[model samples]
Target: MSTTTHETRIDVDPDVPLVRITREFDAPPAKVFRAHTDPELVARWLGPRGLEMSIDHYDCRTGGSYRYVHRRGDEEYGFHGSFHEVRPDELIVQTFTFEGEPDGVALEKLVLEDLGDGRTRLTSTSLVDSFAARDAFVASGMEVGVREGYERLDEVLAQG
Candidate 1:
Protein backbone atom coordinates (compact mmCIF):
# COMPACT_ATOMS: atom_id res chain seq x y z
CA MET A 1 0.00 0.00 0.00
CA SER A 2 0.99 3.65 -0.60
CA THR A 3 -0.15 7.16 0.25
CA THR A 4 -0.35 10.56 -1.40
CA THR A 5 0.31 13.97 0.05
CA HIS A 6 0.57 17.52 -1.35
CA GLU A 7 2.41 19.54 1.23
CA THR A 8 5.31 21.15 -0.53
CA ARG A 9 6.88 24.03 1.32
CA ILE A 10 8.88 26.64 -0.58
CA ASP A 11 10.96 29.44 0.86
CA VAL A 12 12.98 32.19 -0.79
CA ASP A 13 15.55 33.95 1.35
CA PRO A 14 15.47 37.72 1.09
CA ASP A 15 18.95 38.17 2.50
CA VAL A 16 20.57 35.70 0.12
CA PRO A 17 20.15 34.42 -3.42
CA LEU A 18 18.74 31.10 -2.37
CA VAL A 19 15.54 29.10 -2.61
CA ARG A 20 14.61 26.19 -0.40
CA ILE A 21 11.92 23.63 -0.98
CA THR A 22 10.89 20.84 1.33
CA ARG A 23 8.46 18.06 0.58
CA GLU A 24 7.56 14.70 2.04
CA PHE A 25 6.73 11.56 0.16
CA ASP A 26 5.03 8.34 1.16
CA ALA A 27 7.95 6.23 0.12
CA PRO A 28 11.42 5.23 1.20
CA PRO A 29 14.56 7.22 0.48
CA ALA A 30 15.85 4.91 -2.19
CA LYS A 31 12.61 5.01 -4.14
CA VAL A 32 12.43 8.79 -4.11
CA PHE A 33 16.07 9.07 -4.98
CA ARG A 34 15.67 6.74 -7.90
CA ALA A 35 12.71 8.74 -9.14
CA HIS A 36 14.97 11.76 -9.24
CA THR A 37 18.05 10.21 -10.81
CA ASP A 38 16.57 7.80 -13.30
CA PRO A 39 15.87 9.48 -16.60
CA GLU A 40 12.88 7.30 -17.40
CA LEU A 41 11.26 8.06 -14.06
CA VAL A 42 12.32 11.70 -14.25
CA ALA A 43 10.56 12.11 -17.58
CA ARG A 44 7.41 10.71 -16.04
CA TRP A 45 7.15 13.30 -13.28
CA LEU A 46 9.71 16.12 -13.40
CA GLY A 47 7.79 18.96 -15.03
CA PRO A 48 4.47 20.71 -15.28
CA ARG A 49 1.45 18.86 -16.48
CA GLY A 50 0.57 18.80 -20.21
CA LEU A 51 4.13 19.30 -21.38
CA GLU A 52 5.90 16.68 -23.44
CA MET A 53 9.35 16.08 -22.04
CA SER A 54 12.25 14.74 -24.04
CA ILE A 55 15.66 13.93 -22.68
CA ASP A 56 18.68 14.59 -24.84
CA HIS A 57 20.92 12.78 -22.41
CA TYR A 58 20.80 12.10 -18.68
CA ASP A 59 23.77 10.63 -16.87
CA CYS A 60 23.19 10.93 -13.14
CA ARG A 61 26.48 10.30 -11.42
CA THR A 62 29.49 12.10 -10.12
CA GLY A 63 30.78 14.36 -12.90
CA GLY A 64 27.85 13.33 -15.10
CA SER A 65 25.69 15.84 -17.00
CA TYR A 66 22.14 16.02 -18.26
CA ARG A 67 20.14 17.97 -20.84
CA TYR A 68 16.43 17.85 -21.41
CA VAL A 69 13.67 19.81 -23.05
CA HIS A 70 9.99 20.30 -22.31
CA ARG A 71 7.65 21.21 -25.11
CA ARG A 72 4.11 22.51 -25.14
CA GLY A 73 2.80 23.10 -28.62
CA ASP A 74 5.35 25.18 -30.46
CA GLU A 75 7.16 26.34 -27.37
CA GLU A 76 10.19 24.49 -26.12
CA TYR A 77 12.15 25.07 -22.91
CA GLY A 78 15.57 23.56 -22.45
CA PHE A 79 17.60 22.95 -19.31
CA HIS A 80 21.01 21.45 -18.75
CA GLY A 81 23.25 20.77 -15.80
CA SER A 82 26.10 18.75 -14.43
CA PHE A 83 26.14 16.54 -11.36
CA HIS A 84 28.82 17.63 -8.93
CA GLU A 85 28.21 14.88 -6.40
CA VAL A 86 25.91 11.94 -5.85
CA ARG A 87 25.29 9.90 -2.73
CA PRO A 88 22.86 7.09 -3.24
CA ASP A 89 19.57 7.50 -1.36
CA GLU A 90 20.96 10.47 0.50
CA LEU A 91 22.17 13.47 -1.49
CA ILE A 92 22.78 15.04 -4.87
CA VAL A 93 24.58 18.25 -5.77
CA GLN A 94 24.31 19.69 -9.23
CA THR A 95 24.41 22.78 -11.40
CA PHE A 96 21.29 24.03 -13.09
CA THR A 97 21.04 26.21 -16.20
CA PHE A 98 17.99 27.33 -18.05
CA GLU A 99 18.66 27.75 -21.73
CA GLY A 100 16.77 31.04 -21.87
CA GLU A 101 19.18 32.75 -19.49
CA PRO A 102 22.44 30.99 -20.04
CA ASP A 103 24.31 33.15 -17.57
CA GLY A 104 21.90 32.66 -14.67
CA VAL A 105 23.09 29.33 -13.42
CA ALA A 106 22.34 27.93 -9.99
CA LEU A 107 23.95 25.33 -7.81
CA GLU A 108 21.44 22.95 -6.31
CA LYS A 109 21.73 20.49 -3.49
CA LEU A 110 19.08 17.93 -2.63
CA VAL A 111 19.11 15.79 0.47
CA LEU A 112 16.78 12.94 1.29
CA GLU A 113 16.15 12.05 4.91
CA ASP A 114 14.38 8.89 5.85
CA LEU A 115 11.54 9.48 8.28
CA GLY A 116 11.11 5.80 8.97
CA ASP A 117 7.83 3.93 8.41
CA GLY A 118 8.32 4.05 4.65
CA ARG A 119 8.42 7.84 4.29
CA THR A 120 11.09 10.22 3.07
CA ARG A 121 11.61 13.94 3.33
CA LEU A 122 13.33 15.75 0.51
CA THR A 123 15.06 19.04 1.17
CA SER A 124 16.25 21.03 -1.83
CA THR A 125 18.23 24.25 -1.82
CA SER A 126 19.19 26.30 -4.85
CA LEU A 127 21.78 29.06 -4.72
CA VAL A 128 21.98 31.54 -7.54
CA ASP A 129 24.54 34.22 -8.38
CA SER A 130 22.38 37.18 -7.34
CA PHE A 131 19.19 38.10 -5.58
CA ALA A 132 17.79 39.44 -8.83
CA ALA A 133 18.32 36.05 -10.44
CA ARG A 134 16.65 34.29 -7.54
CA ASP A 135 13.72 36.67 -7.67
CA ALA A 136 13.45 36.14 -11.40
CA PHE A 137 13.30 32.41 -10.89
CA VAL A 138 10.66 32.77 -8.21
CA ALA A 139 8.63 35.06 -10.43
CA SER A 140 8.77 32.65 -13.34
CA GLY A 141 5.85 30.60 -11.98
CA MET A 142 8.18 27.90 -10.70
CA GLU A 143 5.88 27.11 -7.79
CA VAL A 144 3.13 25.86 -10.00
CA GLY A 145 5.42 23.64 -12.00
CA VAL A 146 7.04 22.33 -8.83
CA ARG A 147 3.87 21.62 -6.94
CA GLU A 148 2.17 19.90 -9.83
CA GLY A 149 5.21 17.87 -10.66
CA TYR A 150 5.48 16.63 -7.10
CA GLU A 151 1.82 15.80 -7.03
CA ARG A 152 2.35 13.70 -10.11
CA LEU A 153 5.27 12.06 -8.42
CA ASP A 154 3.10 11.23 -5.48
CA GLU A 155 0.76 9.47 -7.83
CA VAL A 156 3.61 7.59 -9.42
CA LEU A 157 4.80 6.53 -6.02
CA ALA A 158 1.33 5.35 -5.10
CA GLN A 159 1.48 3.00 -8.05
CA GLY A 160 4.45 1.13 -6.64
Candidate 2:
Protein backbone atom coordinates (compact mmCIF):
# COMPACT_ATOMS: atom_id res chain seq x y z
CA MET A 1 0.00 0.00 0.00
CA SER A 2 1.31 3.44 -0.87
CA THR A 3 1.58 5.82 2.04
CA THR A 4 -0.06 9.26 1.94
CA THR A 5 2.64 11.21 3.71
CA HIS A 6 5.38 13.53 2.38
CA GLU A 7 3.49 14.04 -0.85
CA THR A 8 1.52 17.13 0.03
CA ARG A 9 2.78 20.41 -1.40
CA ILE A 10 1.83 23.89 -0.31
CA ASP A 11 3.36 26.69 -2.34
CA VAL A 12 3.02 30.41 -1.79
CA ASP A 13 4.53 32.59 -4.47
CA PRO A 14 6.60 35.45 -3.18
CA ASP A 15 5.65 37.76 -6.07
CA VAL A 16 1.98 36.86 -6.52
CA PRO A 17 -1.17 37.02 -4.45
CA LEU A 18 -1.76 33.31 -4.74
CA VAL A 19 -1.42 30.12 -2.77
CA ARG A 20 -1.18 26.74 -4.43
CA ILE A 21 -1.52 23.35 -2.83
CA THR A 22 -1.11 19.94 -4.37
CA ARG A 23 -1.63 16.59 -2.78
CA GLU A 24 -2.05 13.01 -3.87
CA PHE A 25 -4.53 10.58 -2.37
CA ASP A 26 -4.37 6.83 -2.41
CA ALA A 27 -7.92 6.74 -3.74
CA PRO A 28 -9.64 7.16 -7.05
CA PRO A 29 -10.40 10.58 -8.46
CA ALA A 30 -14.13 10.17 -7.95
CA LYS A 31 -13.72 9.34 -4.30
CA VAL A 32 -11.17 12.06 -3.73
CA PHE A 33 -13.33 14.61 -5.45
CA ARG A 34 -16.32 13.55 -3.43
CA ALA A 35 -14.38 14.14 -0.24
CA HIS A 36 -13.83 17.70 -1.40
CA THR A 37 -17.35 18.37 -2.60
CA ASP A 38 -19.22 16.71 0.22
CA PRO A 39 -19.89 18.79 3.29
CA GLU A 40 -19.94 15.86 5.67
CA LEU A 41 -16.64 14.61 4.38
CA VAL A 42 -15.22 18.10 4.49
CA ALA A 43 -16.12 18.47 8.12
CA ARG A 44 -14.39 15.22 8.86
CA TRP A 45 -11.00 16.41 7.61
CA LEU A 46 -11.04 20.04 6.52
CA GLY A 47 -9.61 21.91 9.48
CA PRO A 48 -7.11 21.48 12.28
CA ARG A 49 -7.26 18.38 14.43
CA GLY A 50 -9.12 19.84 17.40
CA LEU A 51 -11.77 22.05 15.87
CA GLU A 52 -15.32 20.89 15.29
CA MET A 53 -16.92 21.95 12.05
CA SER A 54 -20.61 22.64 11.61
CA ILE A 55 -22.19 23.24 8.29
CA ASP A 56 -25.03 25.73 8.12
CA HIS A 57 -25.69 24.96 4.47
CA TYR A 58 -23.57 23.51 1.66
CA ASP A 59 -24.46 23.26 -1.97
CA CYS A 60 -21.61 22.20 -4.26
CA ARG A 61 -23.05 23.08 -7.62
CA THR A 62 -22.46 26.10 -9.76
CA GLY A 63 -24.25 29.18 -8.48
CA GLY A 64 -24.71 27.46 -5.14
CA SER A 65 -23.56 28.89 -1.83
CA TYR A 66 -22.33 27.50 1.47
CA ARG A 67 -21.69 28.60 5.03
CA TYR A 68 -20.00 26.80 7.88
CA VAL A 69 -18.52 27.43 11.26
CA HIS A 70 -15.57 26.01 13.13
CA ARG A 71 -15.83 25.92 16.87
CA ARG A 72 -13.11 25.32 19.41
CA GLY A 73 -14.28 25.84 22.96
CA ASP A 74 -16.13 29.14 23.20
CA GLU A 75 -14.64 30.61 20.09
CA GLU A 76 -16.16 30.16 16.66
CA TYR A 77 -14.96 31.15 13.22
CA GLY A 78 -17.37 31.38 10.34
CA PHE A 79 -16.70 31.11 6.66
CA HIS A 80 -19.07 31.47 3.75
CA GLY A 81 -18.68 31.21 0.03
CA SER A 82 -20.38 30.91 -3.32
CA PHE A 83 -19.65 28.20 -5.83
CA HIS A 84 -18.90 29.75 -9.17
CA GLU A 85 -18.35 26.60 -11.21
CA VAL A 86 -18.38 22.92 -10.47
CA ARG A 87 -17.55 20.04 -12.76
CA PRO A 88 -17.92 16.62 -11.25
CA ASP A 89 -14.66 14.85 -10.44
CA GLU A 90 -12.69 17.47 -12.29
CA LEU A 91 -12.78 21.07 -11.17
CA ILE A 92 -14.34 23.51 -8.75
CA VAL A 93 -14.21 27.29 -8.63
CA GLN A 94 -15.48 29.32 -5.75
CA THR A 95 -15.36 32.54 -3.81
CA PHE A 96 -14.29 32.21 -0.19
CA THR A 97 -14.59 34.77 2.61
CA PHE A 98 -14.07 34.62 6.32
CA GLU A 99 -16.87 36.38 8.15
CA GLY A 100 -14.73 38.30 10.60
CA GLU A 101 -12.95 40.06 7.76
CA PRO A 102 -15.76 40.22 5.29
CA ASP A 103 -13.87 42.28 2.79
CA GLY A 104 -11.06 39.79 2.30
CA VAL A 105 -12.38 37.42 -0.29
CA ALA A 106 -10.42 34.90 -2.31
CA LEU A 107 -11.12 33.22 -5.59
CA GLU A 108 -10.33 29.55 -5.25
CA LYS A 109 -9.91 26.89 -7.88
CA LEU A 110 -9.37 23.16 -7.53
CA VAL A 111 -8.54 20.51 -10.08
CA LEU A 112 -8.46 16.76 -9.70
CA GLU A 113 -6.46 14.45 -11.91
CA ASP A 114 -6.79 10.72 -12.10
CA LEU A 115 -3.70 8.59 -11.71
CA GLY A 116 -3.81 4.94 -12.63
CA ASP A 117 -4.03 2.28 -9.93
CA GLY A 118 -6.53 4.10 -7.72
CA ARG A 119 -4.64 7.29 -7.04
CA THR A 120 -5.71 10.90 -7.52
CA ARG A 121 -3.90 14.21 -7.54
CA LEU A 122 -5.66 17.30 -6.36
CA THR A 123 -4.30 20.77 -6.97
CA SER A 124 -5.81 23.85 -5.42
CA THR A 125 -5.09 27.51 -5.99
CA SER A 126 -6.34 30.48 -4.04
CA LEU A 127 -6.06 33.94 -5.50
CA VAL A 128 -6.35 36.71 -3.00
CA ASP A 129 -7.11 40.33 -3.82
CA SER A 130 -3.77 41.61 -2.58
CA PHE A 131 -0.31 40.52 -1.55
CA ALA A 132 -1.00 41.47 2.04
CA ALA A 133 -3.97 39.14 2.11
CA ARG A 134 -1.92 36.32 0.66
CA ASP A 135 0.85 36.95 3.12
CA ALA A 136 -1.64 36.93 5.96
CA PHE A 137 -2.80 33.49 4.90
CA VAL A 138 0.74 32.18 4.87
CA ALA A 139 1.36 33.69 8.28
CA SER A 140 -1.80 32.04 9.64
CA GLY A 141 -0.16 28.63 10.10
CA MET A 142 -2.10 27.29 7.14
CA GLU A 143 0.64 24.79 6.33
CA VAL A 144 0.12 22.91 9.54
CA GLY A 145 -3.63 22.88 9.11
CA VAL A 146 -3.29 21.72 5.52
CA ARG A 147 -0.76 19.01 6.28
CA GLU A 148 -2.78 17.73 9.20
CA GLY A 149 -5.94 17.88 7.15
CA TYR A 150 -4.41 15.69 4.47
CA GLU A 151 -3.33 13.20 7.10
CA ARG A 152 -6.91 13.08 8.31
CA LEU A 153 -8.07 12.51 4.77
CA ASP A 154 -5.69 9.59 4.50
CA GLU A 155 -7.35 7.97 7.45
CA VAL A 156 -10.76 8.50 5.95
CA LEU A 157 -9.66 6.86 2.72
CA ALA A 158 -8.21 3.90 4.56
CA GLN A 159 -11.56 3.18 6.12
CA GLY A 160 -13.23 2.45 2.82
Candidate 3:
Protein backbone atom coordinates (compact mmCIF):
# COMPACT_ATOMS: atom_id res chain seq x y z
CA MET A 1 0.00 0.00 0.00
CA SER A 2 2.45 2.59 -1.19
CA THR A 3 1.15 6.03 -2.08
CA THR A 4 3.79 6.49 -4.73
CA THR A 5 2.47 3.58 -6.69
CA HIS A 6 -0.85 5.19 -7.58
CA GLU A 7 -1.17 7.94 -10.13
CA THR A 8 -3.67 10.76 -10.05
CA ARG A 9 -4.54 12.39 -13.32
CA ILE A 10 -5.98 15.87 -13.58
CA ASP A 11 -7.12 17.43 -16.82
CA VAL A 12 -8.33 20.97 -17.38
CA ASP A 13 -10.33 21.55 -20.52
CA PRO A 14 -9.02 24.52 -22.49
CA ASP A 15 -12.29 25.35 -24.25
CA VAL A 16 -14.73 24.41 -21.51
CA PRO A 17 -15.26 25.16 -17.86
CA LEU A 18 -14.50 21.69 -16.67
CA VAL A 19 -11.85 19.79 -14.75
CA ARG A 20 -11.56 16.05 -14.72
CA ILE A 21 -9.61 14.03 -12.15
CA THR A 22 -9.04 10.34 -12.27
CA ARG A 23 -7.36 8.08 -9.76
CA GLU A 24 -7.08 4.39 -9.11
CA PHE A 25 -7.38 2.77 -5.70
CA ASP A 26 -6.38 -0.65 -4.49
CA ALA A 27 -9.66 -1.11 -2.68
CA PRO A 28 -13.03 -2.05 -4.04
CA PRO A 29 -15.68 0.43 -5.11
CA ALA A 30 -17.69 -0.18 -1.96
CA LYS A 31 -14.77 0.73 0.23
CA VAL A 32 -13.87 3.82 -1.74
CA PHE A 33 -17.51 4.87 -1.90
CA ARG A 34 -17.89 4.52 1.83
CA ALA A 35 -14.75 6.57 2.40
CA HIS A 36 -16.42 9.34 0.41
CA THR A 37 -19.94 9.07 1.85
CA ASP A 38 -19.01 8.50 5.45
CA PRO A 39 -18.37 11.77 7.20
CA GLU A 40 -15.80 10.44 9.61
CA LEU A 41 -13.89 8.70 6.87
CA VAL A 42 -13.98 11.79 4.72
CA ALA A 43 -12.69 13.93 7.56
CA ARG A 44 -9.78 11.57 7.93
CA TRP A 45 -8.54 12.18 4.38
CA LEU A 46 -10.09 15.02 2.36
CA GLY A 47 -7.49 17.72 2.05
CA PRO A 48 -3.83 18.61 2.39
CA ARG A 49 -1.96 16.41 4.81
CA GLY A 50 -1.18 18.96 7.48
CA LEU A 51 -4.63 20.59 7.62
CA GLU A 52 -7.04 19.67 10.35
CA MET A 53 -10.55 19.13 9.02
CA SER A 54 -13.76 19.60 10.91
CA ILE A 55 -17.23 18.96 9.66
CA ASP A 56 -20.01 21.24 10.75
CA HIS A 57 -22.51 18.91 9.16
CA TYR A 58 -22.29 16.18 6.55
CA ASP A 59 -25.27 14.48 5.04
CA CYS A 60 -24.16 12.50 2.02
CA ARG A 61 -27.45 11.51 0.47
CA THR A 62 -29.77 12.72 -2.22
CA GLY A 63 -30.86 16.29 -1.53
CA GLY A 64 -28.54 16.46 1.48
CA SER A 65 -25.90 19.05 2.16
CA TYR A 66 -22.50 19.25 3.87
CA ARG A 67 -20.24 21.91 5.32
CA TYR A 68 -16.69 21.44 6.42
CA VAL A 69 -13.65 23.49 7.28
CA HIS A 70 -9.96 22.83 6.86
CA ARG A 71 -7.70 24.58 9.31
CA ARG A 72 -3.98 25.13 9.19
CA GLY A 73 -2.61 26.99 12.17
CA ASP A 74 -4.52 30.30 12.16
CA GLU A 75 -6.06 29.94 8.73
CA GLU A 76 -9.30 28.20 8.02
CA TYR A 77 -10.95 27.40 4.70
CA GLY A 78 -14.59 26.51 4.48
CA PHE A 79 -16.46 24.55 1.85
CA HIS A 80 -20.08 23.55 1.45
CA GLY A 81 -21.87 21.40 -1.04
CA SER A 82 -25.24 19.91 -1.76
CA PHE A 83 -25.70 16.35 -2.87
CA HIS A 84 -27.96 16.19 -5.89
CA GLU A 85 -27.71 12.47 -6.36
CA VAL A 86 -26.08 9.62 -4.46
CA ARG A 87 -26.00 6.05 -5.64
CA PRO A 88 -24.22 3.51 -3.49
CA ASP A 89 -20.85 2.39 -4.82
CA GLU A 90 -21.60 3.92 -8.20
CA LEU A 91 -22.02 7.66 -8.48
CA ILE A 92 -22.42 10.93 -6.66
CA VAL A 93 -23.47 14.26 -8.12
CA GLN A 94 -23.07 17.38 -6.06
CA THR A 95 -22.68 21.11 -6.17
CA PHE A 96 -19.46 22.45 -4.68
CA THR A 97 -18.74 25.94 -3.42
CA PHE A 98 -15.81 27.40 -1.61
CA GLU A 99 -17.02 29.87 0.99
CA GLY A 100 -14.29 32.29 0.00
CA GLU A 101 -15.54 32.38 -3.57
CA PRO A 102 -19.30 32.27 -3.31
CA ASP A 103 -19.82 33.09 -6.95
CA GLY A 104 -17.84 30.09 -8.22
CA VAL A 105 -20.23 27.25 -7.77
CA ALA A 106 -19.32 24.04 -9.54
CA LEU A 107 -21.37 20.99 -10.32
CA GLU A 108 -19.34 17.85 -9.61
CA LYS A 109 -19.91 14.30 -10.63
CA LEU A 110 -17.99 11.39 -9.09
CA VAL A 111 -18.14 8.00 -10.75
CA LEU A 112 -16.63 4.78 -9.42
CA GLU A 113 -15.68 2.05 -11.86
CA ASP A 114 -14.95 -1.39 -10.56
CA LEU A 115 -11.72 -2.57 -12.12
CA GLY A 116 -11.90 -6.07 -10.71
CA ASP A 117 -9.47 -7.74 -8.31
CA GLY A 118 -10.67 -5.46 -5.56
CA ARG A 119 -9.65 -2.36 -7.43
CA THR A 120 -11.65 0.76 -8.27
CA ARG A 121 -11.18 3.71 -10.55
CA LEU A 122 -12.56 6.98 -9.30
CA THR A 123 -13.30 9.70 -11.82
CA SER A 124 -14.53 13.12 -10.89
CA THR A 125 -15.59 15.94 -13.21
CA SER A 126 -16.32 19.45 -12.12
CA LEU A 127 -18.19 21.92 -14.32
CA VAL A 128 -17.96 25.52 -13.35
CA ASP A 129 -19.70 28.67 -14.59
CA SER A 130 -17.01 29.88 -16.96
CA PHE A 131 -13.58 29.14 -18.30
CA ALA A 132 -12.15 31.89 -16.17
CA ALA A 133 -13.47 30.25 -13.06
CA ARG A 134 -12.03 26.94 -14.14
CA ASP A 135 -8.69 28.48 -14.86
CA ALA A 136 -8.62 30.17 -11.49
CA PHE A 137 -9.36 26.87 -9.83
CA VAL A 138 -6.55 25.19 -11.70
CA ALA A 139 -4.15 27.95 -10.79
CA SER A 140 -5.10 27.81 -7.13
CA GLY A 141 -2.61 25.06 -6.21
CA MET A 142 -5.46 22.58 -6.26
CA GLU A 143 -3.20 19.84 -7.59
CA VAL A 144 -1.25 19.71 -4.38
CA GLY A 145 -4.34 19.32 -2.27
CA VAL A 146 -5.80 16.73 -4.62
CA ARG A 147 -2.64 14.63 -4.86
CA GLU A 148 -1.87 14.75 -1.18
CA GLY A 149 -5.48 14.06 -0.26
CA TYR A 150 -5.58 10.96 -2.41
CA GLU A 151 -2.35 9.77 -0.89
CA ARG A 152 -3.89 10.11 2.51
CA LEU A 153 -6.92 8.22 1.25
CA ASP A 154 -4.64 5.43 0.17
CA GLU A 155 -3.38 5.11 3.69
CA VAL A 156 -6.86 5.03 5.07
CA LEU A 157 -7.98 2.35 2.64
CA ALA A 158 -4.93 0.26 3.45
CA GLN A 159 -5.80 0.32 7.10
CA GLY A 160 -9.16 -1.31 6.48
lDDT of 1 by residue, 54-105 (tens): 9999999999999999999999999999999999999999999999999989
Q: Where in model 2 is the C-alpha error above 4 Å? A: 1-3
Tens-place lDDT per residue, model 2, 86-140, is 9999999999998988999999999999988998889999999999999898898
Prediction RMSDs, each to the true structure: 1.2, 1.6, 1.1
| lDDT for model 2 | 0.90
Give the candidates in order of lDDT, highest first.
3, 1, 2
Q: Write the per-residue lDDT of candidate 3 for residues 40-88, one digit (tens) a residue.
A: 9999999888999999999999999999999999999999999999999
**Candidate 1 residue pairs that clash:** none
**Per-model TM-score on C-alpha atoms:** 0.97, 0.94, 0.97
Question: How far in Å is the alpha carbon of 44 misplaced in model 3?
Answer: 0.6
Q: How much is the lDDT of residue 22 in candidate 1?
A: 98
Clashes of each: 0, 0, 0
